[model samples]
Target: MAPFLTRLSGRAGFRLAAVSVTAMLALSSCGGSTSRSAPVLPDGADPHAPEVTEISALTFRAPIAAGIIQTSRGGADEEFGLNVTPQWIESSATAVSQIVAGDVQAAQSSYFGVIDAARQGIDVIIVSESYASNPGAASLESMPDSGITELKDLIGKKVAVVSLNSSHAVKIKDSLLDQGLDPAQVEFVELPYGQVPAALQQGTVDASSAQGATLAQVKDTLDTVTIFDYGDGKYNGMAESGWIMKKTFIEQNPNTVAAFQCALLKGTEQVKDEAVYAEILKTDLGFDDQAVASDIAPEFGATIRSEPLQLNADILKKIGSIDEDFDVASITLPTPDNCG
Candidate 1:
């Protein structure tokens, strides 16, 4: 298993990315045509601690990212007089790497990202599960024009995964194995999420699977057939990514992470209300389509479940993607005091 994301190091990447994320959110929220200036980084004590007066979050502009954004609703942090300033990163790899470099204390990425980073000797932990994935949330789709009508068509063909050793790759391999196909037989190429649709159209990739914005963006595209979506039945209950932090962050600022988790869980529960659901959909989640937003809203309670974790670990072990001794219990990072 090779690393699939940008292995960013140092503070320079953090500075530029921090500013970029703020602007990126402003643009996305403003429909990309209009400009909205980001607020300046708030004055603070420890920039890394959410318990501080101001804290920064690093994220990609995707659905899992929305889980953290939901915590900002109703000014949860503001109610405590804490300001959360979000910074943007290009991919999950960057998001987690920046956390390791101490650029930001908290961020979210696929669970395997923590394992991958741990192999590199970077201590990290899952503070909470951020995204409880739906079965069809991510997929590998092929062009009907390319004669890739079945899962077996992917044998000896190129498949697109945004990164290797990523949850997308894990799911694709899981789907292939379930179909009784040998995953090693398929060639998986790294294609940016935005490019996979075009690659399918051009016949460069036999299939591609995507989640979050990419899935929503291309859900209606024609002439493509789904080859491997995280579901189609085999993988029904899997937790996708965690709201992660460097273990050092959790250790040094236990109360900070505790406060963060409490507010997050509270926010998580709040959105479940129908009235709050609609408001979050339009505001923090940024769904232009009311129906679609409601369809994709996250269930916070789902994150605390143990079944999906054991299921996820078992699948990865069978694929040789995770260590044979990988333990689901160990992967459940400790929660802060007073956190449910």
Candidate 2:
């Protein structure tokens, strides 16, 4: 048995023990260890000020969202302010689940999660935008003689995804339908992200979904075929990730939320500048192999756009992931501007 805790609670005053995160706990442990001695905090950081001074958010370790919070300590040239302590969660799906369970006050999630929260009547509100350009960029790789070359060939084939109803599966179906192919023809199975490499080697799956960091890794190691790149013209304007929070929390902690958002946006602007990305990626994200696994561009912006979210809801409705059409504007809060 894997030695792990199914439920995790935040420290005092930020107690959020929500759900059983079986995979996140197990997989996160395998992530590369940090080489530095001291925590890589913002310059002149101070996290233990007071309830009024600190904001707590749950995100995956080394995610762009968390980096933004750490990079910009409230504002430029500000020695110390907006003391934020970022708690690491399992995945976007688990983060959304925790938001619904009320264990996580804030987390990074995609449109699939937004739609699910809408259908479940969860009072989750999206605060900031993380991505919007690339939809579900993936590649279906098989043996040279496997004879699986196109979408039509995927019929009766087993494709691996992180989860059954995950955004990857949903977007892959949308991509397939766009190609005038039947999505019901292909089969999908749930598998761990790490296990995909071995499964593909053993022919357990005809192809596996690849995105961002994982996609780069796949291209570097395997002799694979490129089936589809969702970031292209056909898949532009897809829903990206965003920071979500409970409505009540925004009502109660508006200042803290605004402060956090403004700081993150400043950091996002920094990320947009290519001149500083390499240093920041190595320092903030702790990526040892930055050359092989840099982040995919997603039209990262601070302002939340309604079009992508609406398009996502439409896609989810078509796939029966959601029952009714959702109003993206209703759940999205205006961009926070306390630091500016």
TM-score of each: 0.75, 0.75
Error of 1 at 174 (Å): 2.3
Least accurate stretch of 10 residues (summed lDDT) in model 2? 32-41
Model 1 per-residue lDDT tens digits across residues 1-340:
1101223332355455445444434443332122212111122323224445555677554455554555665566554445555555545666666676687877767676555454434455666776666665566777667778777887899887766656778877777787788999989876666676677767777778766556655556644576665644655556776677766676666556666666566556655666666554455545677335525444344245666766766777778765554554454554333433
Measured on C-alpha atoms, candidate 1 has an lDDT of 0.59
lDDT of 2: 0.58
Q: What is the C-alpha lDDT of each candidate?
A: 0.59, 0.58
Which structure among the candidates has the greatest TM-score?
A: 1
Off by over 4 Å in 1: 1-51, 273-303, 336-340
Tally clashing residue pairs in candidate 1: 3
Model 2 segments more than 4 A misplaced: 1-52, 61-80, 135-145, 284-286, 289-296, 337-339
